[model samples]
Target: MEDAVGYRLRRAQLAVFQQFNEAFAAKDLRPTDFAVLLLLSCNQGLKQSEVAEALGIQRANFVAIVDGLEEKGLVERRKSEKDRRVQALYTTRAGSDYLKELMPIWAEHEERLIARLGGTRERDQLIHLLKRLCD
Candidate 1:
């Protein structure tokens, strides 16, 4: 019922994010953690700052987030070969395995939203438009 785009976007985000949290509750992972895992899984090795930037996470909070993931055994950080002072992030075996399990659930979650939006074709176009809005 919200006419404003920002309000509608926020409402959609909240509903979907809550569902994602519930879906991942068994693993005790939050939506943000899932995003970090996703970035680490796809990128072979990246400096922590790069991950944070790509994910739009703040530098100050990202350190603690990565530390928590490291503690959960989902991620590992090492001294970047390019820069000994910077830490590089990679998903651990456990993280990769967890992603395999979560991907299907993520797909299903997306299907529900796509259904509400119309269909696969519409969803794809909508994503393109949304990306444009963000960029």
Candidate 2:
């Protein structure tokens, strides 16, 4: 083999990340930040801990991420109506609007990546293998 799996994966990650960084820079969103917003869009009113767990992010680190999104007016942290002690996360109107714009761009980006990987079939195979590794 010309290279090991880890080396190839790292190189591919770096290449895609560079493209992602450039694509989102104009929108003032990093990939990590985008993940949080996207999560909130799909799971409205999710508890802080739930978001952290779903994202595999440390609770402490996730707080800073949520706080930043709150500061940006992209998301809000509100006291849960059902649980006085828990704060639920939700995307703001502005956040939803941003997502409306970003989703198409995201789709295009994903398509480009899938093409680079060879096609939909190859991309599917890659995802299947990657999921096995992750598990």
Kindly list the per-residue Cα lDDT of model 2 for residues 5-26, writing each as its tens digit.
9988898889998888877778
Give every collision pair in model 2.
none
Model 2 regions lying over 4 Å from their true place: none
Off by over 4 Å in 1: none
lDDT, each prediction: 0.87, 0.89
Look at candidate 2 and tell me the lDDT of residue 2: 43
- TM for every model, in the order presented, reads 0.92, 0.92
Best-fitting candidate, measured by lDDT? 2
Output the worst ten-in-a-row residue range by lDDT, candidate 1: 20-29
lDDT of 1 by residue, 1-135 (tens): 569988988898899888888777786778888899888888968998899899899999999998898898889998888889988999999989988898988888778888888999998998898899998
Cα shift from native, residue 121, model 1 (Å): 1.4
